[model samples]
Target: MTRETSEQPPEIAEVLARWQETWPTALQLWNPYVSLREPQWCLTTAEAREAGLQDSFAMIRLRGLAVVVDLETVRKLRVENYALQVLAHEIGHHLLVPANLYDYAGLMMRVRLALAGIEDRAPLVANLYADLLINDRLQRTMGQDMASLYRHLREKGIGETRIFLWYMRIYELLWSLPRGFLSCDKSEPVLDADASLGASVLRSFARDWLDGAGRFAMLAYPYLIEDALHQQALREFAHLSDITSAGVGAELPAGMAEIPSSVFDGIVDPREEVLQNAPNHQEADSPGRAKPGSLTAIIPGSDASTGPQQRYMQPGIYVDLMRQIHPDVDEDRLIGRYYRDVVTPHLVPFPVEALGELSGDVLPEGTDPWEPGDPIEDLDWFESALLSPIVIPGVTTRRRVYAEDIAEPEKEKPYHLYVGIDCSGSMHNPRRTFSWPVCAGALVSLSALRVGARVMACLSGEPGSFMETRGFIKEENEVLRVLTSYLGTGYAFGIPRLETEHLQNAKEKTHLLIVTDDDIFSMLAAPRSDGQTNYDIAEQALRRAGGGGTLVLHARAEWRPQEAERLRQMGWVIHYVTDENALFDFAKAFANRFYRSQGNPTCKRP
Candidate 1:
């Protein structure tokens, strides 16, 4: 895409000429197997912007494993001669801190937790922490002239905001440079003290960089709390910022919805640590630290201990974290993934099918000319001899083909699943909070899919529009998208959803499972749009399905006696879960009862 342009000056041309040879050396600094494509050489600033290297002379795009450099901006920043330092730093982004897309999202997740109310400053804080880790390793161990490169940038009259000064002060402390060498002599004792702590954190968590992310962000929080100071830092550090858009246009990373329990241990504030360890305060009597069991010391965003099933971040917090990482992420797809991640750990094992012995009689059907590649066992020498007394290879070839009159094996397949969830105004939104009904539906449906069963998931609310899969399908995401969605329109699950075309024409036995509350009995007694009542429709649906049906209610068993008995008389097994969390237990039992195995005498075929 590069073309000739008068915008390219002689100095820019000179930097481009030598930068090609610098890539291999940058790669070697990491390891011998560290490989990357050649960096995009944008001859002018316009070309650099087009390549998405905006506001920085060099940047890396994690989506394509691409490195982009603007020779013009490199010269403008007056660091054209330090190609190895710049290229290796960009390479360091790929090799180390926030290495892949998942770790990048992880880094953002931790940083967001630390910066609670000031979350818009996450990208800036994350980028700074990443740069510190990469540049520290390069300068201290790899023997790259990273300090000289930074000194040049400092000499460029970059405004020394508190954040910038504090940032540079940490570098000065890390490298043992004189106080004014990188950070000008404007440093105060508070800045020096924080810088000391920052340097200590960098060294301690160098190998486990993601663990250090929260601490570093906590250190940078106060510096960036004010909007004006953050804007100044952005303007001053624009040329050095490389990872601000690292996750743009990249696929969303999985497993980020659940934060590991150990992550909270690394979120200690450096300032708080210093106060707790000071000699004047007695260790046991110190008030600097939070009480042992309190969540006050934990990062403010999510508490893993509070979830009903497996520990997970809040849905709204997860959505916010993802949006910060990828601005254009679709909220619908993101919310679906959040609940899918939450319910994954609670799903049952895939159902196993029993194998019966083959019972078939082999009988000769007809003879055909055998090709040279045909199996020799199938050749009929007598038939070939009848065709010709003297055998010519291709001319006298004959083979007897056999057909098998095989009786079908006794092995049973898993029943297809028809899962209906109530999405009424009473039900909590799964996107904003945890919804046990949605979780139960996902757990059972995904387990069904794992066992080679098709699933038709429906979300219904009475007296309002309903959402469902196009039909019974095998796609997990489509099924989840329907379950995780909220209708919030009507009172209870629409019983007429049982009259869908897929259910009416099902060829195989299907387990009909509906999750609702006591209100469903009210809906069941209500009449349908047609002349028949919903009770008649429910009975017909059970008959058409041919498999036993189950209604899982989030209410006490004694709540609806007459209606429950009528449905029970129609061959629907009523499972009552008084607590919402009990729904997962019901799902596990239901799957085991219906889909576990064919030979298990304890479970009857649905």
Candidate 2:
């Protein structure tokens, strides 16, 4: 492509050189990273596109590691009189807007929220919303000539498509441009009225672009859905959207330390290799900006060498995909109809708090705070060394000064959790759709693990068989596997299974939870493995684990009061759920009671 292209005109090259110089000076105050590593120059759109830019023109990518400029587009955009502004605008995508990988994913997800039907337009909408935010910052904050970029586009005789017009009108109003300055020539202005709302939305959230993005996407929804306007919007952003799709399908890049592969649901494009190798492929493709020294703190999955297949399987993603599988299915009903289906939105991805928030006391401050007579464990070396020189024989402050060691507080010890869910014929299979019950169970199980709790997950049905994690463990996938599996085998959860496995020969102090319905009455009345009644086995399980146990039943209040009474007598807490929505809340309340002191909180129940 580069070999086939004509050389960049001297005028365009000179202009790019100026922007290259201007970029460092402009962003120096906002982002020092630009100074350490400057944006690279791509002499043509082909070079820029080859250099990992999604669009044919200018772009900043690789988490601000490099900026790629298509001088050809820059050359044409200059006819509109603000080519450098576009350069700065691409730079803004990296340093600001959805600034980091997480924020970028957040932006994508937020757009997904507003786009239930027109998901094909997610990348495009996200890109446009991002442009508005970045341009607003440049025009309104730094006082750049952002409007000229649009004014020139308008001069090109392109009719203002709704999104394009909505976007331009934003700049016009924001900068006090004339009402009809960015005209569509159509009798009904495509985005005339909403521009005011867009302007207000921009001002109210000029600083918080991510939140502003949600509102902006909502504003663009009507235009997005109108068949003609939608096509026009798509045509207007064709290049950027193509790039977004290209990036979406692109290969994973090495040194992609900021965003995790899991966040991308496996697709990732790292520009480390591309930036290193870019100059070799094209004419005058310069080695781009310098990568910063440390980003392990900023970019997640810096060393994500291996893990279970993870995706952005948030509730919204789940709902979207499920619709693809059963296209005619009602998603709202799917979310609320079953127990496990509703839980997916609330379950945490991991079992343990990656932040390592095990609560513990701070060690007392003092060097050698412990003396010969004092407990040796309490000795503080630093404080004691300082005290020894000033030590006087009669002074009690100096005597015990070295007694207490200034110690880093240890985090709270995590507990073991045992989760048992009913998977009988009446219960819905989680594998079929979004499983709310399994999701609810996961909410508790992950919370338990986050706080350093070992969780034993079990799927149980009566008579034929049951599945268990066998013993306490911390693997989320293992626990989720049990929760997600379908076992529409028996009539009810086998009480005998819990008695023999968890209650009788428990390896650790475990918190037991049983999820079932009123049908569990038969299991409670049935004989256990020990020949004792089911109630007796559960009672013993509670006493042996020493930790409290809970029984959550999804049955009518009047049906199981008598049956639940026997378990309640055994000191097991009982919670009834009339609606599946309340199940997530209950799971969270239960987890907080058990795991709060040990780790950070997970997503709240809906």
Candidate 3:
């Protein structure tokens, strides 16, 4: 659609004039990448639809780019100068404008053919076009004026040579802007009138080129313009090599022999003056002026004064807090906080058993058989109970107990716990409230280790690749260390190979605990054996392990009903806790169910 009436207001007229002058060139530049044509400036949804457009504003191409601007939307959204400029920039793309010398060459060729024979002065036109092209390229590449565009180009793939050429061209083109007016060394007849015409044409061309380029650059590189200053500040503090190496640097890579040595020498090396700037380096590395114990001091803060206070919240605090709330939260119990808040009340009414009762004695429920001579109350007995495996009902088969059960304890076999943790990109939310999987995994590992279960923590990502940590954990510090080292190994697209491999391994009764957001059921159930997913492989392993197979699915707030049901149907006893406090409750319930079957009277909910 045509621009708004010039009679509307002087400010409106000025804006339209500026837009008309700038948009043509910008559109031309963007045309090569995205085809743009006939832009309609709409004022309402009705107007946009009447003009065959679908969005408030969009670059649609029936044949070429058509930038549709909803005028009604502009008023409704209260779009100002910046927004107007952005809209005009999109229109500029429709105009197929050029921003650099190479691109302008094509534009010049088109213009020359269009205006042929009218201007007899071909040499002057050619020279003027060349100069303008160079100047525009230089301004775009090296001048601070188009630094935003340069930054965008840097993010893309523009080389150092192109940037340098852009700068050099700017200087040369500035000299050529007024060349027609200046007296030359080898002068021919000075056609003053023709020269003037040439100057006017060149000025018109330059103004349009610059405006279009600026507008298009802003739109094309929107994020760069907003982030340029911050990025510049970051560059100031960054290693020089990092900022300037190869594609980003002021010079080419080592093997590019065409680059001159003089040009190479200009490349700055912040590391060169290391000896003299040692103090400055140290100062830069020194902790900033943030006070200790403040919020700012905790993260992204100065380390010098804060000491280790903000390094990480003390593990002791976490352990003490867990212990105070759920006194039974020890090493061997799989404690989780998924549905703790919602399900703890439901679980509290049930009789929660302890570890000693599950493994040491076969006492009936509600019967206290502890005597003064009984060794169950001793710390060593509790420690041994913590390490021993308890046979939960429906989980393990009944086994024979030897004299070593109460006397010399049999050495526990380290069980290989293949923990498949979902660390896909979607799980990258670091906020405490959203980090249930990480927290739950940590607590579960701790519980397993405390109860003498040899735990192997594995993060499932990609296909077969998993970060697995084995060996018995003796303390909380070791557990945290392993957990902290677990980095997200990118997104997973298929069922993890571990699931299949775990099913294949027949030697040991492997307990595979999959801590995930329950999105893998479809993939896992693909090759169902008798309409069952490979979950039977896990169940069978647990059965082989005397019924100790455990599958714990830690869910987020938005639970998938079908997936949850499928997991439950697959024989996974789901412990759903909503907060950290409930993790202990879940652990206590789990311990009581499995650990107190032997009636040692030591089983109690913490």
Candidate 4:
């Protein structure tokens, strides 16, 4: 009998009512997957909230089918028609049983029994059978319903699932469903004949009940299934393998070797063609061949190749061509070398007791010298020596005749320190030794804090490489945290204006210290209409504090002498420190000069 005409079974009605009461939001969210003409199952927000039904679930039974939804989930959905989609998907599952009670019963029994054996050796066997069944039968059934669902949703300009095969391949099994019948004993297997017959009878009763439910789902929630299918298709497309061989001319470099076939297969885009030609084949094969002595074919010699030559292009030719085009490219440089050169040398070849001596006073007690979290005392003592600047008493000095009059204490201006660190992708190269920047930044920050200077630290790389302290003044740790957050990023967008926006607004003396590779000098020096180098920006900004502003340019030692001279001419204090160990000395000297000059104002003149 048709479900609409048949009396509503009380247990089936109760289950539907419970589903509605338990997860109204999930049901609503899945409405797009549901079909129209499916029976309406009423659920309230309070009931859904009580069950914590935030995620969606599809319920299938011999008697009927339904989708339960949480109320909060429905409210959060971007699409208002989610409820309709959910209902349609439930109907799709119900429609799988249409008029085939015996088949439906047998399928359900097998699925249920397979699910039960999942925890033991039988799990593998059960899973294999279930996978086969779902892939072959269930997917075909779902595909049929999906076609209708797709047409309905597509007509409305909703979403559609174009690559249904991808989903069919990945999601053949209902991974979420529990395997095995928990109520039955593990050792006892259900008799195949009895299960088949019983399932058929139960399915007949279920078919009548679901006929009403399925119609409601189909009528009310077509888009739910449609959108899900669309998403599934997109996911499958992302994972699809597109294998192609390397091009004919492609080859490994001379002295270099081919990548292992297995290794190459993992990352090689399947779409790329493999190279097969050998180098110098054409020239060797067409020896002594000459073209017609026409103006287009030959100019001076009146002889040139005019016809196709059959010669294998060796893979080495392409490798050589690539090497010429990108001579400086070295992939190995990208991986960190810090462990070999910096970390290893300092920690190894010496006893732990030697660490304290090597580190001097800075390394703290109770820390390992080799580990990252090792005690500072056993590592290096330079930081503690630098700390002396903060505690040293100010000494009075005789003013030189050319010295400007010292300002009164009341008028002593607070200094603004702007530190720009280059965190571009190139900075990540271990060959460049990036740890210097990190350590230098940390030391500079600590020193700035000790001197009561307001510090603004920034990392520049890509369009959004900036990371800075926001209204951050007090906590030194906070500033360090911001600095450490910088990731080596891709190409940076804007010019490195190290001096302008950061220091220009300060009423106090300004110190713009830029730590970067020499590569950035040209970008910083390109003339602005205002006739200002980045250094000029700082000079103008610090002029407000009675010319107390200074620019310090720290770059790699390999920078051209001309670059240093040009910066010096621009009135910047330039220093070249090639390696990390030297950076601490440079900072120490710079800090000494800065602090000592506070007492002897005319000690060093620009």
Candidate achieving the largest TM-score: 1
Which lDDT tens digits does candidate 3 get at residues 333-442?
Answer: 21222212112222313222333323464432222223344453322333233435663322222222233233333333334344456666555432222244555555
Residue 46 displacement (Å), model 3: 83
To one decimal, what is the Cα RMSD in angstroms of model 4 from the true structure? 24.8
Which stretches of candidate 3 lie above 4 Å from their native place?
1-418, 428-436, 470-482, 490-510, 525-551, 554-559, 577-606
Model 2, span 1-606: residue lDDT tens = 001213443476576666666766556535666643666677767776666654446655543345566666656544313445665676676677655554655566556544545665666777777777777788777777766656656765654565676666777777887766765433244355566666777787667766666556656666667677777776666544312522322222212212233333211112222434666653332222113221232123322221112222333344443342234555433332222323334444443333533345444343323335665555444455565656443342232331233334434455577788988887776644344467678778877776567898888887777888857877866777777777888888887666555556766667788888877888778864566787776777788877778888887777857777877778888888887656767886777666655233332211
Which portions of model 4 show Cα errors greater than 4 Å? Answer: 1-414, 429-434, 462-464, 490-496, 499-502, 525-558, 595-606
Question: Using Cα atoms with residue i matched to residue i, what is each candidate's TM-score against the true structure?
Answer: 0.85, 0.57, 0.29, 0.29
| Cα lDDT for residue 380, candidate 1 | 88
Residues 1-606, candidate 1, lDDT per residue (tens digit)?
111224433575677888888889989999999889999999989998988788899988898898889898887766767889899999999989788999998888788877767788998889999999999999988998788888878877985898788889999999988888888888987778778888999999999999998888878877887789888888988988899888878999888888787777777677777766787954443222222323363543434323453467778778888887788889888988887787677665554444444457788888989778888888889999999988776779899988776554445567899999999999999888877788788888987887778999999987887999999999998999999898997999999999899999999989899999889988888865678998999999999998879898888877879889999999999988888888877877777666554442123465
Which lDDT values do the candidates have, in the order given? Answer: 0.82, 0.59, 0.36, 0.35
Using TM-score as the yardstick, the better of models 1 and 3 is 1
lDDT comparing candidate 4 with the true structure: 0.35
